[model samples]
Structure formats: structure tokens, C-alpha cells
Target chain A: MTDLSQQLAFVLEIDKLKAVYRQTTVKEDKDRHENSAEHSWHIALTAQILKDYAEYPIDIERVVQMLLIHDIIEIDAGDLFAFAEQQDHAQQALKEAQAAERLFGLLPPQQHEQYKALWFEFEAAESNDARFAKAMDRILPLVQNMNNNGGSWAKHKISQPQVLARNKHLEYIAPKLWQYVVQQTDLAVSNGWLKKD
Target chain B: MTDLSQQLAFVLEIDKLKAVYRQTTVKEDKDRHENSAEHSWHIALTAQILKDYAEYPIDIERVVQMLLIHDIIEIDAGDLFAFAEQQDHAQQALKEAQAAERLFGLLPPQQHEQYKALWFEFEAAESNDARFAKAMDRILPLVQNMNNNGGSWAKHKISQPQVLARNKHLEYIAPKLWQYVVQQTDLAVSNGWLKKD
Candidate 1:
């Protein structure tokens, strides 16, 4: 087989990995249930949109790379409900790191290092790209939850303070995006989508 | 809640989407059965590693962006098996585009536009960045399949000619990566992982 064809075959095989999640809406509208692929795509786009708002003169490309792979570890760790017991966070992170190693290793060696680095950067959230990527990563779901009438939070019995406490970093990372999220949260509370707590 | 915290929450929500197809393995090897998020990460890294090898002077940022969001549509369209019936390709693309519209739209308006543009460019495959991104997209899986001993090709009953016809564009897109893919395919066939056909 020719080289290109081999690549195509590889691409075709990657598609099978899409069935890991079902993206259900706990208490939100039908539109709120996005698949894993959709979520990553949206966040990567979020990175592009918010690149300019970064506190530093960020590398948009690096931010995009971070966003694209940031959550891939979730595949193996399973989506650790953010509001779940905080103790699980460490274990989840460990599982995700292992997943990252296996998944990113799919590329040729040179490419593998590049991705593994970006994934690490995002996880570390120390670099400007990682910070910005982390910020966008936090912002997308607030919009989804608000738009969907607090779907997951309501279903999970998540409270306003819990939501606020979990997501306060947005203000420092991207103020504008954060401001928007706060407004949505208030609206959700007033609308009774979430408890005042 | 602080905006930052809210934004972080958003990112966590997006992570849930990958649960749809995270651990799936097609006819490919365990490593090749990477999730969509991992796939995006790998391609972006591939773009970075192979950036120097491009025949033309390309915008690395644009290429990275393209790689990051290229397969997101697969979330909605579901992945099409490469060797599956021919009629599904167009249908899958259409579904993926629609999915892109909704998913990318989740970002703030400005971000929505920026991300949509990157996704569109990758889909168009007309620009230099797009070409390089496309090449990386093809190359990653080629490596994985070859390393795994023709993991998917043999199971799917793929022919050498069919593989070549589908992937020849890699030659023009990124010659070095294409060369590597060709070498790997030869090795796989020689190892009896793939039939001579």
C-alpha cells in the first residue's frame, strides 16, 4: 500500500475511539449534550477566540495544542465529575497521565514528544499557553450549563457556591470570559437552575 | 463564583464529551485505538515536528490550529470506517460540519468566529497550513498501524492499491512524512501483518 493510503487507514481507525462517551443532558436542553469530540473541538476553537485576551503574549498555536489534548486523559480516567469528591482528583490525574502516554505515543517519535509536551504544559498550567488553554477549558462548560439551564449541576445537585468555588480561576485567566460566566451563574441561580447554597 | 473557576468548570464539562469513544479499538492495535482528544493532540504535535519538512514556507500557527480541530466533527458524524461503503463519506462530512457549527458556536461570539475559521481552513485543505495539517493527520495513524503489525488493515481486508489510492496526497503534502509512512507500510507487509494483495 502507498504511504498516503496507510495514513488514511490510520485516520479511519481513530474514528472508532469516538464511542467512549454518550454526552447526555442531565437537566439541560437537547443541544447541551455534546459528544467528546465536539467538546474538544469547541475548546480548541475557544482557545483561538480567546488567544488575544491572554495575560501574556501567548502563542495561539501552543494554546490550541493544549486545548485539543487537555482532556484526552478523560478517556481512560473517565470524566471525573468535577464536583465529585476532591480526593479522586489525584487518582484521576494519574489515570489521565497514563492515558496520555499511551494515546500520544500513537504518533511517530518526533511528533509524540511534541504532543506529550503540550499535554504536560496544559496539565501543569504554568505556561501562558497552558493557563490560557485552562481558562478557555473552564469557560466552555459554564456557557453550556447556563444555556442548557444548568443541566449537569442540577442533576448532580451541585450548588451555586460549589460551582463558584470550583471555577474562580477564570477571573484571573481571562477576565472577560470570567465576567460572562459569573453573569450566567447568577442568572442560573435566579432562574432556580441551581441552589443558592 | 470567580470567573476563572467558572471557566475551569467549563473545561471539565467539555471533558465529558470524550467518553463517547475514548477506549475503542478498531481493527488497529491498542495504541492505535486512541481517543479523539488524543488524536487531535497527536496531529498538532505532528504538525510541529514536521513543520521544518514542508516544501513551502508555511504558517506553523495555522497548521497547528488546523490539526487541533480537524477531527472534532467526528463527534457528531460518528466515525466512518474507512473501508466501509463509499456512500458514507459525504454523509459523514455533512454531519460533522453541522456538529462543528453547534459545538464551535458554544464559544463567545469572537472566539466562535476564530475557531470556525480554523476548522473551515482545515476542511478546505486549500492553504499551505491546511496541506501540512492534512499530511500530519494521515501520517500519525500510518505509524501506529505499521508499528502494531498492520493492526487494522488485515482485519478490514484492505488492499495495498486501495490504501495507496487514498493516501497519495501525503507525498505532495509532506514528502518526508510520506516517505516514513511508505517505509513503515513496507515493513508491516514484510512482517506478514499485511497480505501482499
Candidate 2:
């Protein structure tokens, strides 16, 4: 197939991301679950809006690209809940890796390398952009959970410590946002939406 | 307010993009209109997948970033339909410019500059990256119109020449994709999805 056709096919296929529901809900809209596509778009927009708070200055463009394609594998591997500990990690990783290869591989060779690298960089969370992106990824759902009266946290019986542990890396990546999270988690505890123990 | 709070505020606010519907519908799902957020995510993914088809060797990352943030002004300005001619051009441009300033200005100064500049680059459509991004932006809707049995094209009574004119720039930006589009338009015209005269 021509590169354009391949690309169009990929575009149509990845729309499935909209159907892959996540554990998080929209912060403003509590009526439904947020899909991976919406979450990815939100974080990309968030990365641009929040770049300054990162511990390191980042290439905002690269960070935006990472967020755009990062969760695409979820179209195949499915969204794993941050609190769901019942899954097999090795199997999930294997499925996602395969998903990444199949999905990113749908692009031309050079473009495929570009996105695959970005996904790896995001997963490793070592680069400055990746680190900042990771912080935004972790922080947003926490805020959503808090705002929606502990949303997924309440639904899953997620404890405050569980929330804190999942996002503790935010302190290193985005200190100020982590502070905001701490304040909100306390508020959530007081509101009886989050488990104190 | 601290930068993180501002960032979180911006993220929560931009969720409104999910509520902003576009003229296009998802190629896979025709029951509802595609939201601006989903459209942005789709084009960004399309940019990466089809970068090779660009007449110029473009910076795919920059193109992805542009597509991700380009429609965000729509959050404030609202989406303008490609076939809609009743709107005032100067007034629409003014609203979008103001929207760009307000929406992008939600970021820290540096990020605000980065995104504002990218948004302008996309609007100008002079850069290789922006040109390719524009082609993807145009092609998707055309495909969607084709997929949904003439969709807005039929609804708006859009002619083939009108469709051709709106997307003429694609020929210069992405020759191969433009060829694909020409072939599709021929099919569309024959099928009466697009008016021939």
C-alpha cells in the first residue's frame, strides 16, 4: 500500500483508542469514563500548559508528541488501572510491546522508529520531557479523582497511601504539582471520599 | 497562583474540547459528530503516520505538536466548518486570534510562547511541517465525508470543485496523498456523494 493509505488505515484503526476506557474520568464531566484517546489529548495539552513546573526545562514539542502517541498501544493492550494489582505484569508488558510494534509499524519505517522511540522514552521516563510528561500523566487523574469525590479511588476503594505511592514520583518530576496533590489528598480524606488507612 | 495550580486549572478547562463538536464524524462511528479533542488527536497521529509522503522532509515531531494544539483555539473561538460560507471571515479571524491568546496564554510564559508560535506556524502553513499537518487536517474530513456516505458534503451540497479548492494546497505539501485524494474525489463524484458540477 502507499504510505498515504497505510497512514489512513492507521488513523482509522487508532480511533479504537476512543473506545478503550480508562480508570479516570474527565475532571469537568463526571457522567462517564475518559477514553485513552481523550486522556492522551488531555495530557498533551496539559504538558504544554504545565511545562514550566517541571524540574528540568523540556522540548515542549517532543513532549507533546510523546503524550500523543504514548497511550496508543492501549488501543490494543487496554488501559491498566493504576490501582489494579491483580494483573500479570509480564503478560501486560508483552501484549503492549506487541501492540506498539503492530500499531507504530503501520507507519512507514522511519516514522515508525520515531514513535516507537518516543513510546520507549516515555515508558522509561528518564528524559526531561518524558519526566515532565510522566508527572502530568500521574497528576491529572489524581486531581480528577479528587474533584469527582474520589472517582476511581472511591470506586476501587483506593487508599490515600496507594494514591500517594502511585504518584510519589511526581515530587521529583513536578514538586509544586506534588504539593497540590498532597493538599487535595488530605481534602479527599476529610471529605470521606478517600480511605485514610 | 503557582504554576502547577495554573496548569491544573488549564487542564480542567480544556476538557471542554470534548464538548466542542466538529463538522467531521469519526470514520468508524457516524452516529455522533467528532469532538475537536478527538479530531486534534487523530490529525496528530495522522501527521506521524504520513510524514514520509510530504514533498518535503518535514520535522514530524513539530508537525505532531502543531496538530495537537492547532484546534485548541476552537475551545474559545469554536470550530468553523470548511463548507460554511455565511460566517464573517475578518470577525472569525479576530475571534480565533483572541482565542489563541487566551487559550495558549494559560500556559507559563515559555510554553505559551512555544505553543502560540506553533499555532501561528500552523495557521500560516508556510513551513514544511505545517503544510503536511494541513494536508492531514484536510484529508481526514474528506475521508470521513466519503466514509459516511457523503456526510456533510451531501448535507451541505458541497461541490467537487469546492472540495478540490479547499484542499488544493495539499498538492504542493504532499504530492502522493494529493494523488490519493484526487482518486477518491473521482470516486466521490461518481457516487454522487460530491456534486459533479
Candidate 3:
């Protein structure tokens, strides 16, 4: 295959992401859930916009790219919703790592390596850029849950403690956004979006 | 407002793009159409994957960012289907300009200006980065049309001549990708996806 065909095929292959639906609804619409494709777009934009709040200075471009490719493996492994109570995350991670190898391996060699590296960095979430990008991903759904009549939170009967525990990493990576997260979680409790006790 | 609040608000506001669906559908599922947010994600990824095919070297990081922000103003002005015959593009452009002002205005001044400039650069499509990004945007729908049993092309009676005219810019930006574009168009014609005038 020619370079263009390889590139086009890779581009076409990732469109599978549009079919992978997640639990979070669009900000306004509760009847329909947002798909993984838009979820990736939202988090990438969130990373771009919130780079300033990272614990240390970062390459914003790298952070946003990391966020863009973060969940792409979900196209094969499927979207594992944050509030889902039954699934074993360790098992899911193993399946997704295998999925990443198959999907990203479709790209040209150099791009395959680059994307795999970014995917691993995002999974690690230890570097400053990945930490900030991880924070961006967490906050979007938190805001969505607050907006869509408590969205998945109320749907799953998620508790405030559960939500806090899941997203608390923001407090260190982005202190200012973390304040909003805490304030919103508190408001969610009073608003009955989360279980009070 | 602090930078983070401005950033969060900006990120949340753009979620409207998810509700702004487009003419193309997911590759296999004609049951639902694609959304603007995912369109951005697809094109941004395409830009990354095809960056090597660009006529000259490009700062791909900038190109991907430009692709990400290109259609965001459509969040307010709404998506303009390329084959739509009756819509007033001038009026739409005016509305989109105003939309850009309101949406990007939600961020701190530096980020606001940075995003606005990227948006305008994409619209102008003059720089090498912008040109390649524009090419990336155009081909996705063309390929989608071929994939979905002629998709919008058949629905809108889009012709081969029209597709060629709309996408001719690819010839100069990245000849290799443009070659795939032409071959796909030819194959599309033979496959009865486009009228053979």
C-alpha cells in the first residue's frame, strides 16, 4: 500500500471511535449519551485550555495530543464508564492495552510508536503533562454530571465520597479547577445529584 | 475570574458542539449522523497521521490545533453542509464571526487571542499548516460518502464534478493525499456513489 492509502486507512479506522458510546450525556441532552469520539475531543480541548493550571509548566501541545489519543483504545475494548460499579478496572485495562496494540498498529511505523508512547504516558499519568491532561479528562464528566440533572451520578446512585475519591487528583495538578470540582460536588449533594450520606 | 475558571467555562461552553450534528454518519451506522465535535477529532487525527504527506515540512502540532478549533464557531452558527445548495454562506459567516467572539471570549485574553487567531488562520487556509489542515477536513467526508453507500452524496445528489471542485485544494497541499482523493473519487464514480457526468 502507498503512504496515502496507509494514512487514509488509519484515518478511516479510527472513525470506529464515533460508535463507542459512553455513559455521560451531552451537556444539554440527557436522553442520549455522548460518544467516545466527542468525549476525546472535549478532553483534548479541555487540556488545551487548562494547561496553565498544571502543577508544573508543560508542553501544552503534547498534553492535548496525549488527551486526544487517550481513549482511542476504547474503540476496540469499549468505553468503560467511570461510574459503572461492576467491572474490574484492572481487567479492563489489560483488554484495552491489547486493543491499543491492534488499533494503533494500523498506522505507519513512526506514528504507531509515537501514539503508543502517548497512550502509555496517559495511562501512567505520572508526568506533569499527563497529570494535567488526566485532570482535564476527569473534570469534564464532573461538570456534565452537575449539568444534566446529575447525569450518570444520579443514574448510578453514585455517592459524593465515591465521586470525590475518583477525581481528587485534580487537587494537586490543578488546584484552582479542583476548587470548582469540590464546590460543584458539594452543590451536587445539596441538589440531590449525589447521595448525602 | 481566575484563569482556570475562564478555561473551565470555555471548555464547558464548547460542549454544545456535541448537539450540533453534521451530514455524515459513522462508517457503518447510518442510524445516526456524526457530530461537529467528533468531526474535529477525526480531522485532527487525520492531520496528525497524514502530516508526513504534506508538500513541505509543517509544524504538525500547530496544524492539529488549528484543525481542532476550525469548526468550533459552528457550535453557535451551526454546521453548513458542503453540498447544501440554498444556505446563505455570507450570512452564516457573519453569524459565525460573532459566535467566535462570544465563545472564545470566555477564556483569558491570551488564550482567547490565541484561539481566535488559530480559527482565522484555518479559515484563510493560506499557510502550509492551514492548507494541509483544510485538506484533512475535506477528505474525511469524501471518504465517508464512499463508505456509507454514497452517504450524503446520494442523499444530496452530489456529483463527481462537484466533489472535485470542492476538494481541489488538496492537489497543492499534499499531492500524495490528493492522489488518494482522486483515486477514491474515481472509484466512487465507478461504484455509483457519484453521478458520472
Candidate 4:
């Protein structure tokens, strides 16, 4: 296939991301789960809206790209609940790296490298943009839980400490969003929607 | 509300876009229509993938941002099918502008101005970035149709002339993508998936 064909193929392949559902419920409809594609969109938009609060000044464009493609691997690896115990970090990373190679490799050579690098940067979560992007990713589900009477938290019986631990990066990377998360989690506990322990 | 609260409110409200279904079906599942949110995600990715084909050099960050938030008005005004006859574009514009205000207005003032301006620029489609963004928007549905064996075209009995006419902007703004569309449409017609004009 030619370069355009390769790019178009990648586009079509990534459409499967729309069907890969996460544990978080859509705010409008509690019965339904949020798919990775829309979740990616929400976080990309969040990166722009909340960039002002990032502890490190970020290149917003890179952050948006990182957020956009960050979840494409979910199409293959499937979403592992952030709070799930007995998690296999090593296995998850291996699966996602393979998935990333296959998906991003569908693009032309240059774009494949460009997008693959962004995905890796996002996975590393160390750069200014990556750190900020990860914070938004963690915070969206936290807010979604608050929106739906502690959505996934109540469903999974998640505690405030667990939530905070999963999102600890936000403390140093996005102080304002971290504060918002703390306030929301406290409210969740007070409302009896989250575990107090 | 503080800026953070206002921004969070906007985020929650825009979640409604995930429920606003477009005519195009997810390529993976024929029964399910593509929602505005995932469609926005796809086009944003397309803007990055196809940026090199633009008639003019575009600040892709602006193009991607424009695409991400463009269909958000569909949350209130709802999607308008491109090939539908008797489209009251003036009325459509009125509804979308109102929706834009109510939705983007949920953001803090500065961010509101920034996003709303991007939305309006996409609608105008006059600038280099806006023109290229518009081209990507038009091509996505067309490709979706071709991918699913004239998915929407056969469903609506749309003709080649109609498809070309609807996506005429691509001819000038993204000539390479326009060429790809022509080739795909010809293939669709040959396969008896699209009506020949």
C-alpha cells in the first residue's frame, strides 16, 4: 500500500477504539460504559481546558496529541481498571508495546515514528506534557465517578486512599487538579458513595 | 463558580456529545451509529495524519483543536446530514450558534473565547487551517461509507455527483485527499455499492 493507503488503514483500524469500552460510565447514561475513543477525546479537550493548572508549563499541542493516541493500545490490551489489585504491570506493558507497534506501524514511516514516540512519551509520563496528560487521564474518571454518584468507585468499592494513590502523580504535576480531586473524593465519602477506609 | 468549576462544568456538559449519534456507523459494527464525540476524535486524528496534503501550510495544532470541538454544537443542535435535501442552512447556523454559546459559555471567560472562536472559524472555513479542517471533516464520512460498502450512500441512495458536490471543498483545500475520495467513490460504484451519476 502507498503512504495514503497506510494512513487510511491506520485510521480505519483505530476506529475499533470506539468499541473498546472502559469501566467508567458515561455521565449522561449510567447504564452505558465510556468507550476509549470518546474517553481520549474528553481528555484531549481536558488537556486544553486545564493546561493552566499544570505544575509544569506544557507544550499544549504535544499534550493533546499524546492524549489522543494514548488509548489506541486499549483496543488490543483492553482496559485494566486502575484500582484492580493483582495487576500485572509487566504483562500489560508488553501487550501495549506490541499493540502500539502494530497500530502506529499502520501509518507511513514518518507518522508512524511521530505517533509511536508520542504514545511512548505518554506511557513514560515523565515529560511535562506526558505528566500533565496523565493527570488529566486520571482526573477524568475521578470526576466521572463524582458525576454518577461515585461511578466506578462505588461500583468497585474503591476507597479515597486508593483513588489518591492511583493519582499521586497529580500532586506534583497538577496541583490544582490534585486539589480538585481531593475535594471531590471527600465529597464522595461524605455522600456515602465512596468507602471511608 | 471558580474557573476550575466552570471548566469542569463545561467538560461534563460536553459529555452529551457522546450520545449524539451521526448517520455514519462504526466500521466495526454496522448496527451502531457513530457518535459525535468519536467522530470528532477520528477527524482530529485525521487532521494530524493528512496535514501534509493541505493546499496551504496549516498550523496543525489549530486544525486539530478546531476538529476536536467542531461538532460539539451537535450536542444541542443535533447532527445535520451532509447529503440531506432541503437543508435550512440558515436555521442550522442559528441553532448551532445558540448551542455554541450555551456550551462554550460553560467555560471560564478566556477559555470560552478561545474555543468558541475556533468553532466559528471551522464553520467559516475561509482560513488555511479552517479550510483543511473542513476538508478532513468532509472526507471522513465519505471514507466511512466506502469502507462499509457504500455504508451511507447505499442506505440513502446517494449518487456520485452528490458525494462529490458535498465534498467539493476537498478538491481545492486538500487535493490529494480529494483524489483519494474520487478513487474510492469510483471503486464503490464499480462494486455496485454507490449509485453512478
The top-ranked prediction according to DockQ is 4
Question: Worst 10-residue stretch by lDDT in candidate 2 chain A?
Answer: A24-33
Fnat, model by model in order, equals: 0.13, 0.55, 0.58, 0.58
Lowest lDDT sum, 10 consecutive residues, model 1 chain A, at A22-31
Tens digits of per-residue lDDT for model 3, B1-197: 87777776787788888888888888644448888998999888777777777788789889988888888898789998886665577788899899989999999999899999888888888988888888888988987777678888888877888898878878997887677778888888888888876
What is candidate 2's lDDT per residue for A22-99, written digit by digit as tens?
877765443567778878887887776666677766888888878888899988898888776656666778898999
- Between prediction 1 and prediction 4, the one with superior TM-score is 4
Instruction: Give the per-residue lDDT of model 1 (tens digit) for B63-148.
Output: 87777667666656766766667688778778878988876666556555777788888878788778778777766656666645
lDDT by residue for model 2 over B146-192, one digit each (tens)? 76798889888888888888788789987777777888999999998
lDDT comparing candidate 2 with the true structure: 0.79
- Per-prediction DockQ scores? 0.15, 0.52, 0.67, 0.77
Residues forming the 10-long window of minimal summed lDDT in candidate 4 chain B: B82-91
Under CAPRI classification, how is model 4 graded?
A: medium
Off by over 4 Å in 1: A1-39, A72-79, A90-127, B1-42, B49-56, B69-126, B141-157, B187-197
Q: Model 4, chain B: what is the TM-score?
A: 0.95
Which lDDT tens digits does candidate 4 get at residues A1-197? 89988988888888999989889888675459989999999999988888888777799999999988999998889888787655576788899999999999999899989899999998998888888888889988887778787788887888889888878889998887888788888899999888988
Question: Per-residue error at A139 for model 3, in Å?
Answer: 1.0
DockQ of candidate 2 compared with the true complex: 0.52
Candidate 3 lDDT score at position A158: 87
Candidate 2: Cα lDDT at A27: 54
Model 3 pairs in collision: none
